[model samples]
Target: MTLPIVTAVDQAHAAPLRALIDGKAKPLGALGRLEDLAIQLGLIADGPPPTFERALLLVFAGDHGMTADGVSSYPASVTQAMVATFLAEKASANALAKAVRAELRVVDAGVDADLPAHPKLLDEKVRRGSRNAAVEPALTPEEVAEALERGVRIAREAAAEGFELLALGEMGIGNTASAALIMHRLAPAPLVECVGRGAGQDDEGLARKLAVLERAAARSAATDPLAVLAEFGGLEIAMMAGAVIGAASARIPVLVDGFIVSAAALAAIRIDPAVKDYCVFCHRSAERGHQRMLQSLEVEPFLDLGLRLGEGTGALLALPIMRAASRLLSDVASLDDVLNGRL
Candidate 1:
């Protein structure tokens, strides 16, 4: 099916953005990143800063075949176990979602195991797990399309349920490999620069992971991004791309998590660059490659807490900062009000 045409945010609101930021509430440009954030929000909303009433954190869980290569330190079963942890509210994402008052929705994008039915988990599994891209394609084109559709459906449902903002997250072992592939494809940097030690891999493990990805890239050299995604993209990444598109079409702010989510955002941007207008880079992840990815996107994230943990932890941490930015832009008194100089 043809995806809906997602429009970019209105640039015509620049004047109002300046008015809001330069209205003499504080020293000129003293609010720092918060000022820029308020302006960005104004532009995204096409007016003043929007009131984001409800936030939805959608965590897409999947499994990677490359984990069998001993490239990662963690066992492949960790992916499924982590999904279970998310379902049980025992994961970091769950804790952050609770703290931020955001509803967490975990989707089984393509876990290797058959997940038991749970009220909170959306069973949209496309496959048990992807094939090893080191040797062959990870997913078929049909599978990629299915995963993307599942993401779009979920985002639409969340928007309809009154979620004003959406935060993207992922739970998949070996996902950093998928993310590295995406970064290598989208960024100007080469694979070596985009790849990093995920989950604390030793130098040897990192070399093996890089070799596998380099081989994967070489095998898929003549392919486009969709083709590359079919070959190397995880179910979670594809689904996140779909959700980013869906949220942009719905005109909700899309708060992007760290590297993995950024990789999905890169895919979404490839699908439709206009989606960036609705995206907010939540923070700079501690992963070395994430810095290059953010530089490529030309976005300054809200925070930098030396965090490398995915699961939307950084993004959730950023919600309060966004809230504060909106409040300052909309609620704080102007200098004229304080000085009694207004008519």
Candidate 2:
């Protein structure tokens, strides 16, 4: 199915947005990034800055074929285990979401194991797991399509449930490798530039990971991006791309988490550049490739916390800042009111 082409917020919306921010008692543009964020929020909401009442953090969990090459310090089984941890509210994503009062949705996008029935888990597995790209394609074209559709469906459902903002997260053990591959191919950069030491991999392991990605890149050199994603993209990445598109089409603000989510955003932008308008980079991750990805997208995140955790932690951390932006835009008194000296 053809995904909807997300349209940009109209220029007409800018005047009202600027009025909302500038009417505040603070000197014009005195709020700095907060003022800019208010404008972006108003544009995304297509009205006065919106109150983010309900937000959802969707964490797509999956496993990668590249794990077999000993690229990651953790085993492939950690993917399933982390899904359970997320369900148990023990994972960092869950903790951060809880701290921010954002609802969490854990999806089995393509976990290797049979996940036991759970109330919070959304079972939408596209495959048992991706194939090791070092040996062959990660997923078939059909599987990629299904994963993308699953993400769109989830985003629509979240919107229907009254979520004003959608936050993207992921939980696949070897996903960083897949992200590196995607970034290397999509960005105007080489594989070595996009590759990073993920999950504390030692120098030797990082070298092996790079070698596997180099081989995968060479084998898939002739393929287009969609074909390459089908051949090598992780289920979670494909789903996150779909969610970004869906959120953009729905005109809801999307808080991008970290490197993996940024990589997915890059893929979505490749499919449709308009999707970038709805996205807000939450932070600059500690991972080396994150800065390159950010530069390629031409987005400045709200924070640079030196964080590398990828489970929407950055997005959750930015929640307060977003709230502050909206509050300042809507609640601050006008300079005219202050100057009248009515009191």
- Candidate number of the best TM-score: 2
Model 2 — TM-score against the truth? Answer: 0.96
Per-residue lDDT of model 1, residues 1-343, tens digit only: 5676888877877777777678766888898888878877777767666677588898999999988886578998998899889889999989989998888888999999999999889999999888898889899999999888878888888989988889999999999998888788777479999888889999999999899888888877734557767888799999999999899888788899999999888888888899998899998998879999998988888888999989999989999888887777778878888789663
Alpha-carbon shift of residue 333 in model 2 (angstroms): 1.4
Minimum summed lDDT over a 10-residue window in model 2 is located at 222-231
Candidate 1, RMSD to the unseen true structure:
1.6
Query: 179 in model 2: Cα distance from truth in Å?
Result: 0.3
> In model 2, what lDDT does residue 123 have?
94
Rate residue 25 of model 2 by lDDT.
Answer: 79
After TM-score superposition, what is the CA distance of residue 132 in candidate 2 from its true location, in Å?
1.2
Per-residue error at 155 for model 2, in Å? 0.4
Model 1 regions more than 4 Å off: 341-343
